[model samples]
Target: MEISWLGHSCFQLRGKNVNLITDPFTPQQESAEPPATLSKINASIITISHNHPGHNYVQGVGGNPRVVRGPGEYEINEVLITGVASYHDDEHGKSHGRNTIYVIHMDDLVICHLGDLGHALKEEQLEAVADADVLLVPISGGKSVTATQAAEIISQVEPHVVIPMHYHPTPDEQRPAQLDKFFREMGVEAIEPQPKFTVTKNSLPATMQVVLLTPR
Candidate 1:
């Protein structure tokens, strides 16, 4: 499988001839990269997790991709996409309804996208994410799970690789930085990539690890 961060909680995943883009943001949202500077994208499937602008700017994607809203299941190309229900708040107390976390799987890898997940998972939620080999998690707090909550979920899911996102890495004029807190709570060694990576089934590392990836 191949994955590329597109800043914030946005990421593009491609494998088995299918392309999946998750939680894309509009230009005005907090991002490490500028929207006008983004390369044109053509995804086979586009997923929006919730109604939040940062997670649901449907107009930003350059392609007329088959769009999927939160909380559903479908098959695109050879990948099985399951939308598991979650929340963007500790409970659904803050007028935010439900959020959807996507689990995508192919012959080689199982990838989970924690879409603005606002709270920790129950055992059932953990089981739902069990097949994920690479887990895409939110690192910032408030609207999503806290760093410690994310770490605990990672431990429960036991993904081979945990990729942290949704938090700023540098203290810029936009969002506040929170990657260090995420790393500390991870409680495990993490892989540092040079912004992008390519991997086949044979290239997957043996031991579990958390990785902090930046936008492409």
Candidate 2:
């Protein structure tokens, strides 16, 4: 499968038979980073984490995708997806509303997208995403989980590949630090960024590693 980050929490996971996108953000949203254009997005399935404008803009995509919202089990175009209910804030969505965590089975690999997840996983959530091959996590320190919290969560999940998202990559005066804070928490000074990530079930490593993708 090929995974491409389109800025913020949006990602396109492409397989041989199916293509899926996660949390398509609006262009005008504050979280939208440079080159975060939605006109180029085309997917067979689109997953919305919540009703927030930053994540629920389905019209931006052109492929007439089957949009999946909230918690449910769905099989679209041979891809199996399980959406687990989560929250946008740590206080059970009281502050930022509810979110959905999607675990997708594609190309014999289990890919988990933790949509705007604001807190550490509960026992049930952990069970839902157990043994994930690739984990898409929000590591920004603003509305989502902080860098330290994200590192702890990564430890608990122990996914084979962890991809950090929803960060301020552009030069924003308010939140200038991009992935630096998260990298610090992970005890890494630098990691070479890749344009996209491609992996197969056989290519997965035995141990966990962090991959920083340059949004395209």
Candidate 3:
């Protein structure tokens, strides 16, 4: 399967028979800079982590895809998806409402997308995502976990590969400094960002690996 980042927490996962997009962000009207455009992006399935504008803009995606918005078990086009209930804040949704962490089974691999996850995992949450071969985590600390918390989440999930998201970059100015903290917390110096990431079951690293994907 191949994965491509589409800015913010959005990602396009391409498999053998199915294509999936996670958390498609709408254009930020308040900002002077244009947000990532989702025009012409087609997916067989779209998984939404929450109801926020940045994560749940279904109309922006084409193909009339089946949309999964909350915690549930769904099977679409040979892909198995389990959305585990989570939160958007540390206070059990009192501040930011509910979030869903999706564990998707496709192409003989387990991929977990933690959508705006705002806290460390509980025991049950950890059990649900412990089998993740690839983990998509939010590292920016606005409404989700911070860089330090993100590293902690990584240890809890213990996935073979990790891809960080939800942080600022370029025009935002704080991108480099924010990511630098995450790298330091992860005990890495620096990793060059890739345009896309391709992985197979047999090709997964024996140890946990951190991958940086440049938003498309």
Candidate 4:
């Protein structure tokens, strides 16, 4: 399977028979990095973590894909997806609102996308994503987990590969500091970002690995 980041928490996960997109954003949302246009992007399935403009915007995607918006279990085109209810703020939905963490099974691999997850996982939530081979986490603190919290989540999941998202650092700003803090917490200095990440079940890493992907 191949994974590509599309600005913010959005990602395109391409498998042998299915293509899925997670948390597509509207272009109107302000960000340090401009998002790739979703106009021509096509997906067999589209998973929206929440109804927010930055995470919802289903009309932006093409192909008339099947849209999954909340907690549920779904199977389409040979791919299995489980959406576990989560929150967009630490206040258990009081501050922000509900979010869905999607655990997808495709191409013989388990991929977890934590959409704007605002707090550390509870035991049940951890169990839901414990089998993830690749974890997509939010490291920006606005409506999601902070850099420190993200590192903690990584330890809890212990996925073979981790990819950080929702962080768009601009020069002369604090976002860059947050990203640096995440790198420090993960015990890394820097990693060159790749355009996309490609992996297979047989090629899974024995130890935890962090990959940085540039938004397309």
Query: What is the per-residue lDDT of model 3 for residues 1-115, given as tens digits with 9 covering 90 to 100?
Result: 9999998999999999899999989887776443546777778999999999889888888888999989989999999999999999999999999999999999999999999
TM-score to native of every candidate shown? 0.88, 0.92, 0.95, 0.94
- By lDDT, rank the candidates, best first: 3, 4, 2, 1
- What would the per-residue lDDT of candidate 4 be over residues 25-60, giving only the tens digit for each residue? 888756544345677788899999999988887777
Query: What overall lDDT goes with each candidate model?
Result: 0.76, 0.87, 0.92, 0.91
The candidates, ranked best first by TM-score, are 3, 4, 2, 1
lDDT of 1 by residue, 21-63 (tens): 8988778757645375243777778888887777777667766
The pairs that clash in candidate 1 are none
The numbered model that scores best in TM-score is 3
Model 4 has a clash total of 0
Any residue pairs clashing in model 2, and if so which?
none
Each prediction's RMSD to truth:
3.4, 3.2, 2.4, 3.0
What candidate 1 gets wrong by more than 4 Å, as runs, is: 29-34, 37-39, 93-95, 171-177, 188-193
Q: For candidate 3, give the lDDT.
A: 0.92
Root-mean-square deviation of Cα positions for candidate 2 versus the true structure, in angstroms: 3.2
Model 3, residue 180: distance off in Å is 0.6
lDDT of 4 at 6: 88
